[model samples]
Structure formats: C-alpha cells, structure tokens
Target chain A: MDKTVNQKAWFLVLPVFLVVAFSAVLPLMTVVNYSMQDTFGNNQFFWNGVGWFKELLDPSTDLGGRFLASLGRNLFFSLVILAIEVPLGIVVALSMPRQGWTVAACLVILALPLLIPWNVVGTIWQIFGRPDIGLLGYVLNHIGIDYNYVSNEIDAWVTVIVMDVWHWTSLVALLCYAGLKSIPEAYYQAAQIDGASRWAVFKAIQLPKMNRVLLIAVLLRFMDSFMIYTEPFVVTGGGPGNSTTFVSIELVKIALGQFDLGKAAALSLVYNLIILIVCWIFYTVMTNASAERKPQEGAA
Target chain B: MARIDLVDLAHSYGGNDAPQDSFALKPVTMTWRQGGAYALLGPSGCGKTTLLNVISGIITPSRGKILFDGEDITPLSTQKRNIAQVFQFPVIYDTMTVGQNLAFPLKNRGVPKAEIDKRVAEIGRLLDLEPYLNRKATRLTADAKQKISLGRGLVRSDVAAVLFDEPLTVIDPELKWQLRSKLKALHRELDLTMIYVTHDQTEALTFADTVVVMHDGRVVQSGTPAELFDKPAHTFVGYFIGSPGMNIIPAEVRGREAKVGDHVIALNRSYDKLPDGAKIEIGVRPEFVEVVAPAPGLLSAKIERVDDLGRIRFARARLGDAKLAARAPAGFTSPDGTAGLKFDPSHVHVYADSLLVEGAA
Candidate 1:
C-alpha cells in the first residue's frame, strides 16, 4: 500500500510558515540589511558591502573591542554558571524527598525562585545584597569581612554569580529529579541484590540515567546565561568598571544607546553563531556519550 | 545450598494499625530440604511473593524467624542472606555487556577475578549466552535478557538458594518452555535448592518435586504432584490443581451411605458426624468420575455438553442442580438426553466444611 502524495496538506503548513517568515525572517533580514550596509541617517543607507562586519571583527575599533570583551565575559559567565549549577543541582536532587506531601512542598519551594521573573530576581538580590539594610551584606560586614556588592568589582561578580546560581539551580535540579524518577525500582533492587554499594549504584544506575537530562540542562543554562541582559542590567547596570557587561548588554548599548545598528547587528550574528556552535558541541558530545554507553550488539 | 526453614512466619503490610484480616501471609511453618526443588504455587495475592521476599530477607517478617540450616537469618539483609532471585521481569544492567551482567554478582562479592570469569563463562554457556558475551544486555531479546538474569543468579558460588518469583512470566511461550527446561537441567546439575513461585500449575507440577499450594495467605497443602493429583488434601486443592477442577456436590451423610438430591450413593467409609448443620460434600475429579450409559444408574444426569479434547474427553452434565464434569477416553459414547454418572469408590472424596475428611475416600 502506498500513501497518496498529499500536496494539498502543505497548504495547512503554509500559514505557519508565512507567520514565522513575517515575525522572524523579516526582522532577521532587516538585521542582515543593517549588518551589510552603513546607515548614516533615517531612511538613508550606504552600501558598505561587509565593511561593518570587517570593522566589528577588528579589536582596534571601539565597537569591536567592546564586542570581544563582552563576548569573553558572556562565555566565562556561562561556564561559571554551569560549573556551579550542574553538580549542585544533582546533589540537591539526590537529597530531595522522593515521596509523600514533603515532595510537593519541596518542589513548590524549589520552583519559587524560578517562578519569580528574571528582573524581579535581580531586583530582589540587589536589595538583599545592600550593605546598610540587607541581611547578607550586614552579616558579612559584622563578621569582619569587607563585603560591598555595589562598588567592589569582585563582590559584584560574586553577587551576580550567586544570584544566577540561586535562580537557575532549580531548573537543573528539576530536570535531574525527573531523570532520577524515571529509573525503575527494579534496577535499584537488582543492584542491591548484586551487593552494589551506594556509590556503585549511583555510578552504574543514577549517573547514566541522568546523562540525557543533564545535557538539556547544560544547553539551556548555557544559552540562557550567554544571552543574559535583563537581570544584570537591572542589578548592577553593567557598572563596576564594565565587568558584568555581557554580549547582550553590549549589543543593547550599541543598538539603542549609541544607535550603531550596523555594528550591533553584526555582533548579534557573531554572538548567535557562537551559541549555535557551542550548543552543537554540547549536543554532539552528550549524544555521542549516550550512544557510546549502548554496548555493541553481537555479530550474530 | 542450605535448607530454608520458615518458623511461624507471618507478614502484614500495615503496622499496628493493620486489621486482623489484612495479614498478607498468615502464620505458617514450612521447611525446604536442601538441594530439593520446590514450587510455591498460588494465585495472585496469595502471599507467595511475600513469602519469597521474607525468605530472601528483602522483607523482615512481622513475626517469627527464618532459619537457614538451623541459623536464624531473619534479621539479616538480602546481601547477608546470600541468596539469588529472578524476578517476573528480566533485570540486567542495561549499560553492561552480557558477560559483565553475568559477572556482576560475583564481582560485588569480591570474588577472585579468575573465578568470576570461569563461573561467568560456565553459566553463560549453559544458558546459551556464550556467543553474545560481548553484546550489550539492552540489545538482546526479552528471553535473552531473562537468560542473563538467570545467569546472574547462577554466577554466585556461595548462594544459599535460588528463588524465582514467577521468573518466566515475561518470556514468550516457546522460550518459556525452553528456559523452563534449561532451569530444570541447571537444578539437576548444580544440586542447588530452588524455590520457584508461580501461578501456573503445569510449570509447578513439572518443575517441582514438592508443590506447596497457597490460598488466602495460607498454605492449603504441600505434596508430591502425584499425591496432589490423586488425593488433594483440601477441596481448594481439589478444585485448584486439576485442569478442569474437581466437581463438588452437596450431599447428606449417614453411616456408610450418602444422599445426593433424590438418590442414595454408597460411601466406602462410614461418617459418624452427619449433623444437619454441618456442610457436607463429595469432591471428585473429572478424571475419576466414570460416566455410564442411559438412566437407572446410581445418579442420573442430563448431558449438557461433551468436549472431545484430543486424548481425553469431558462429559459435562447436570444432576439435581449440581453440575458434574467427567473425563473419559476419546470416542466415549454419550446417551441422547440422560446418562448415569457414578463416582468411583476409591476416588470419591468426602469434605466437611470444605476441609477434606481423612480416610473418607
């Protein structure tokens, strides 16, 4: 039996395609237009022909130097976020209660930080880290440590990292919790019967089970942290010597503040390409590890 | 191998709040002779798995002790008990090769590497898993995975006994038969005491030397297959053991005679306790109840249906509102409307309140 070639079915898909093209493709083409040419004023453009892209690549120019530094900071922030969150999430997920009303309570509490809007989280932390009235800063200062998140560069970076960790560790924990839940009781029972220790069981059963979800968590955390703008902008306003000004902040500054649309558009493409490449690497490594975990079939 | 003794063991899922009737396993005492093959045959929720779990030390019995060769092992854990169990579903480490899965139990015990390899190879070959030793356990068919599960159990040298909790339930029928035979062969060769739990009667009867039939959390009877077939200790056994269970007809007992509806049937043994309040019945297997021609026999029955089952034929009839099934040889003749169904004197079993009367056949 052969399925009829339903060419008419594409008509149903055409609406979605048209909507995506109008919403995403049109704006992206405008960005591409801005990136390729120099816009001197409103409604007037000069065909620069990759001139802006060339200027954006050179570190000597103001826009290019800011873009490279911000890109480096974005990559570093993403790495730091992942490093703190993944293991911390797994540990938290492991310690979480598996059953009863406590599970609901824990899940709700774990999700509370995630539910608070991003800028709101930044605002909350901003007030919470103030030296005069906030608990953290006041306690740290009284404890004989010079702690001020506003003016201190290291302190500001610590505050951002801590805020990011508090905000997103729940996502990783939730994902890992789901992964841990999917493993059957039989596997644990079998491991127990085989006299496997707790660590052995985690290594053989829990770790392998968590691989796929950890991949998703890593990719999501990386992408979200790389393109982060709202939270840091609300908290520190990209101050303390331009330390926390990531790629998104730099792009916003060039595009909206200085109105350098061409440079910002090119930087946005570079930033998008970086994320795409890194995410592809993450996905490839994770999937390859999973595929490798599957022991080979016999020749017969 | 060690002899397993369950001493006055009982289990209830609920704690102090457990109702009296909620006992999953009613207090029972039994012993399994070392190196003997035994089958715990029962229906679902009959406490067979509970009993197996208790013996495996997975569950501590609410009361009583489990003794292995006269040593109380009830307080020990599963690993301390050193027993192997195959569950209903196959369990193999999906990440490991077949060889690794087989050798896992041994490796966990800190067995010498050379010994582990030898044992793994031997068990793998016996289960016909040698060719797929390097293959991943996850890639195999269900039967092959089940073979790996069984191999895991066999890999351990210090196992007290191997317990199977309906281990073949997941296997295809054809592979079930094959695995059953392989298990039987292993039992014979290794001289290991094995207790198999299953609801299938044929598997129980064929695999076990002694079959302990359980019902409602209590052991109804434990006997050889032949004894269970010939003289079921309880009416439950009589009804549960046979292919088409036993026929139980209400009867009134007096001296050496019994009254079945409107007819008087002679009993081989006299019953003194023939009170009107007591429930009395005659239990007979279809194989034992001989069908005779026409009417004017001891008890006349109206033939409802006759099923020719290749080698054996069953004549189902109604006699005074009591349904009777009698098995006969193939090509047995049946009358048009009515026929005489008589219980063989030696095969007739009398029961009082569902309990078999001793020496009353």
Candidate 2:
C-alpha cells in the first residue's frame, strides 16, 4: 500500500483557521497588545512595559487592591454556588418524574430559567428584589424582616447570590437529570433485589452513575459562577459598597467606566488565565480519577 | 431455599381492561421445587422474563397469589421477598471493588461484618473472582462483571431463590460455556432454587435439568430435557427446542393412522376422537424419521437437499406440497431425487390447535 502524502488537507483547514483568527485570536491579540501598553485620550498609545501588570498585582496599589478583592469575592461566590447547586441539583434530578407527560412538563420548567438571557435574568431579579415594588421584596418586607438590598451589604450579597442561584442552578439540575436518565432500568431492579434502601441505592448506584455528569456540572457551574457579572451588576450595581462586585464586573468598570484600558486589558488577561488554569486542573484531576472506570462512564 | 408456586399468576402492562393478547404474561400456574435448577426457555417477547420477574417479586402479578414455601408473598416488595435476581445486563456498583459489589446486598441487609466477609470470600472463590475481588468492577470485562453480579446474588445465603434473566447475553462466546458450568456448579453448592431465563435453546438445555418452554405468553411445557425432546406438550415447544426443530405437517387422522395428503402413516397408539374442526397435524423429529429408497406403503418424498452436520445427517425432502426433514443414513444418496420417509411410530405426535394430543394406548 502506498501512503499518499496529502498537502490538500491543509487547505481544508485554512477556512477554520481564518474563522478562528477573526473571531477569537484577533480580539485576544488586541487585548494582549493593550495589556502591554498605555493609552492616552485622542486614540494615542505608548509602550507601558508591564507597568499595568505590576500595579494590578501589588495589593497596595488601587488597581491591585480592587482586583484582589473582586477575585476573592468571585472565588467565594463560586464556592458557595457550587456547595448549594450540586447537591440541590442531584436532589431535584432524583425527584423528577420518571415517565409520562408530566416528565416533559417538569423538564420544561427546569429548563425555563436556563433559557433566559443572562441580562434578562439580571433585570428580572433586580426588579424582583426591589424593596417597594417587587413581589419577593414586598412579601419579605410585609413579613416584618428588615430587608433592603440597596442599604445593606449582606442583603445585597444575599440577593445577588440568590439571583445567580435561581438563574443557573437549573443548568446543573438539567445535566444531573440527563445523567440520571442514562442509567438503565435494570440497575434499579438489581438494587431492589439487593435489598438496598433509598440512600444506599443513591450512594451505590445513582451517585456512581452520575459521576461524569456531576464533574461536568461542577466544572460548568464553577467557571460560570466565577465569571458571573450581568445578574449581579443589574441587581446590586457592585454595591452595597462593592460587596457584590465580582471579577468580571470590576474588569468592565475599569475598561468602560474608568477608561483604564491598560489596567482593564491586563485584568482581562489575568482573569482568562485564572479560569483556564482552574478548568485545566479540574479536567486533569477528573479525567484521571475516572480513567480507571472508563468504559462505563461513556454511557453519560 | 424455598419452593415457589405461581397460583393463577397473570400480568398485563396495559391494565385489567386490556384484551387477552395484550397480556405480557398469560395466566400461569406452576410450582418450582426448592434447589432445582430450572430454565425458562423462550424467544424474545415470550413472557419468560415477565414470569421470572413475577417469581422474583420485581413485578407484581395483576391476579393470583405467589407462594414461597406455601406462604403468600404476592404483595411483597422485592427487597422484602428475600429473592436474588441477576438482570440481563450486568449491574455492578462501578465505583466499588468486586468484593464490595458482592458484599453490597449483605451490607444493605445489616449482616454482620464477619458474615459478609465470609460470604463474599466464598462467592469470590466460587466464581473464580478472588484475584479480581480487590479490582474495581468497572475495569473488568463483560463476563467478569457478570460474575460479580452473580456473586452479589449468591452472597445472600438466606435468599429463597436466585433468578437469572439472560445473564450471558453480553458474555463472549468462548467464555459462555465456562460461566454456564460455573453457574451450574454454584447451584449445586448453594442449593438455591435457581430459575434461569434464556432465549438460546443451547444455553437453556445445557444449564437446566428441567426446562420450561414458553410461547406466546404461555408455558407450553415444563419437563426434563429428555421429556422436552421426546414429548413436547405443544407444537411450539417441539419446533423451538431442537435444531431444525420437529417436522410438522397438516394431516387427516383416524384411530391408529394419519394421512399426509393420500399417503397413510401408521401411529403406534390410536389418536381417536380428536376435537371437531381442529387443525390436525403430525409432528416427528428428524431423528425419528429415516430417509431411504422409495418404497411401497411409505411416504414418498422428493429429496431437496442434504444437510450433513458432521455427527448426523438430515435430508430435506418434500412430501406433496409440505416440506419435512428426516434423518439420512450414513453414505446415503438418492439417485433420482426421490426418497421414502419411515417414522418411528412411537416417536410421532399429533397436535391439534398447536397443542399436543395424548394418544390412547
């Protein structure tokens, strides 16, 4: 058999490369350029030579302080979101209707929040948590609890977290539901024959079967919550006094609000790198752990 | 171990108002003796699995009572019934080691740790799974995982019965024989009432002492291997149990005689007073019918083809408009594509409406 040395295959890949360069590489290059340079008004630019990166890293500097605070806030928010969503998602998935028309109905309801645009979700929650007008706000206020998001830091954080949870927990639930559905009916029958209790079935069968999807859910939820901006931005506007401000919101504030292009570009690069590193770690650790049980998890 | 009795047991997935044909399992009354290895033999959709599930209490019958050693267990849940069922597909806790998978049932039932360990070890050795006991079950091949599933079922010593639902479907062809023999040995060592459900005739025949043949949601015959081969109670069983099956042809019957078209064949015993307007058919296995030179007073047939199966040979021949297979003697040849069929009268059976008719001696 003669092996054909084909250079024509490279031409087929050309279109994809051009599309990626236009859609992603070009914009990222611009950010990289801006990160290394300072920009003056009148569309003028000059080399800054890592000055913005230095300022961004130093906690004593204004840019660095804001960046660290928001990074900590983002990490904390992601942790809390994951802690609440994964278990809650599994529980919700377990309770989902196994069959009939009701299954479609329940799936639709679970998917409703995920289908909404992020900005729309933010806007909805912003109005919904208002002290005077919104249903949730009005009800909470009528119950005699002191709850005002605008004036109180904890209230603002709570509202933003709840809003994010309400917006994204469906994503986790839907993923887990798909995982649970992939399990064959025979597993349940076997579990019953084994004299397994509800919890034992979950621990032994359901949870193990859901392993791959839960890893996916955790990674997706972690990355998404870490980069969350629109909902919190609309609901709290980074107040009560920056308490609800996350990394993405702070980056937007620097670039658009303050016109600190150098600082913002540097922050953007760092933020992207952080998400990348965390996701890489997650993928590596998870794939390695599941590799011992490779063939079964593919059913997911 | 316990004897299981299905007293008028029936099931229909479509509810009570559904028509008779819609019943997944037609009304069945049977008793399975304790410690007997039984095989529920049938093709797919023949209600073998449904019957097995009913026995295991995984499915509750729509009507009638199930008895475990004379105690009604019709309404009992599978977990409470103390019945172990291995499914068609191997179901193992993927995260657990093979030993842990075996121990899961005992652990779930709050068995003492020492007892669980001893049983797990015993089952491991029985299935030759000792080396793989500490290995994750998910890493094993389909055959080994099936062993783990079987081990889990056998781990519980107090279970009344063990039901296997086509458990070898995923096993490799070469390994099937080994696993099957292992299961037979386990049944003997454990002495549990084991009911194996399989669509494969070879698997069913080799695995069970008594094979229960089912067809179209009914138990056609439940008898020993020899009985099933020699006297299948239904035409379906006769056709289903053997390779190339029994040759059945429409015939006109009278006392001590049956006619295939104008060709008369002698019956050892008289099948007189057969039901009126019933479909009368004569069934005889190829092993019982001999293909020979065309002769007088014998059914004449045109030899269509010869199938030499190494050990035995069968001649496919046409009698009038119906085709039949009959045993061809060693070094046999038909010079003019014509042959005569000689049936062993005692081995021949008469069927009416697909059910076998017992002839009067």
Which numbered prediction scores highest in DockQ against the true structure? 2
**Error of model 1, residue A136, in angstroms:** 1.4
Over the stretch A1-300, how does candidate 2's per-residue lDDT look in tens digits?
999999999999999999999999999999999999888767889999899889988999999999999999999999988898898899999999989999999989988998999889988988887879988888899999888999899888888888877877788889989999999999999999999999999999899889889999999999888988888888889998889899999999999998878889999999999989998999998978777566754422
Error of 2 at B253 (Å): 1.2
Error of 2 at B8 (Å): 1.2
| Candidate 2: residue B360 Cα off by (Å) | 2.1
lDDT of candidate model 1 versus the reference? 0.86
Give the residue spans of candidate 1 off by over 4 A. Answer: A1-17, A279-300, B273-277, B328-336
lDDT of 2 by residue, B92-129 (tens): 89779999999999998999999999999998888899
RMSD of 1: 3.2
Question: Taking the candidates one at a time, how many backbone clashes does each contain?
Answer: 0, 0
